[model samples]
Target: MQGHRPSQKQLYDHFAPKMLGVCYRYARTLQEAEDFLQEAFITVFRKLDQYRNEGPLGKWIYRIVINTCINGIRARCRFSDTAGRIDVEHLENESTAHPAAHSEIIELVRQLPTVYMTVFNLHAVEGYPHEDIAKMLDTNVNTVRSQYSRARTLLMKKLGSGPKTNENGKRG
Candidate 1:
């Protein structure tokens, strides 16, 4: 299938669900996630030619979706920052835990502050290293590390558990 090209509808049909799952991880609301998914699919189709076929198509599309989500978050942050600042402490202190039988973990993750959530998802979910995440977010590696630490702490607190330790007795 070297010379083969899937139609846009075919690509959308195959990838939309998976890509929407990725978007939902970053977005705070379902509507926002849907918007990001639509925008990402638009970008994927526009940049389809840049995919060199050296790797699986899904990986390539996943990268694009991640970039699109990051960009959307950045843009939203910029707009919100310009308008006014949010009391992150208040938001964090609010009751975030919900008694949902399913999607409780995802709901907990969504309650995290944007920076912490982004770092946590990138590191723990996407399996990106701190150094790579630093580059991707245009911040220092130490900052990413700090954010990841805080994210883990918050998550553990919300989950009503102590932090997990590795075999070496360091925080996992």
Candidate 2:
């Protein structure tokens, strides 16, 4: 895929759909997910020579996609939060987007605040550990854990399945 348009297009075609799903898990809208997909592919092509060929190409491409998502979050979040922090601002203009049909749960995930959604997708959907998430986000482990906790709580509450705890935080 290096310096070859047809090969690049072929690779993109083969991976774009699944990679877009990966992007969507971390993006708020379809447009944002598409943008991330394009960006990742661009990076993939640029770094094709660095692939050591020790692993499956799809896994390598997936790593690029994940890195692209995290980098996108970092780039957009820097202005909202301090350096070395992953806390991000809510999308003020998100209400204008008319998303195409997708899963109810996916839409609910997208409804979360950017930081919570990112942490949640990285840890839960991607099967990454909290420690890895903290490293990826350049944040403390406890912060990632709390963010994951908050994300789960929010999702459960939205799903009407939050822990059935009483006033004292015990099971009802």
**Winning model by TM-score:** 2
What TM-score fits each model? 0.77, 0.80
Instruction: Supply candidate 1's per-residue lDDT for 36.
Output: 91
At residue 73, candidate 2 shows an lDDT of 84
Q: Count the backbone clashes (under 3 Å) in each candidate.
A: 0, 0
Q: Could you give candidate 2's per-residue lDDT for residues 1-172 as a string of tens digits?
A: 5999999999999999999999989887789989999999999999999999999999999999998998998887741221111111221122234233226566777887788888878876788998998888888888887777777777666656566678886767
| CA lDDT scores, all candidates in order | 0.76, 0.77
Error of 1 at 139 (Å): 0.7
Q: What is the lDDT of residue 58 in candidate 1?
A: 98
Q: Give Cα distance to truth, residue 149, candidate 2, Å.
A: 0.3
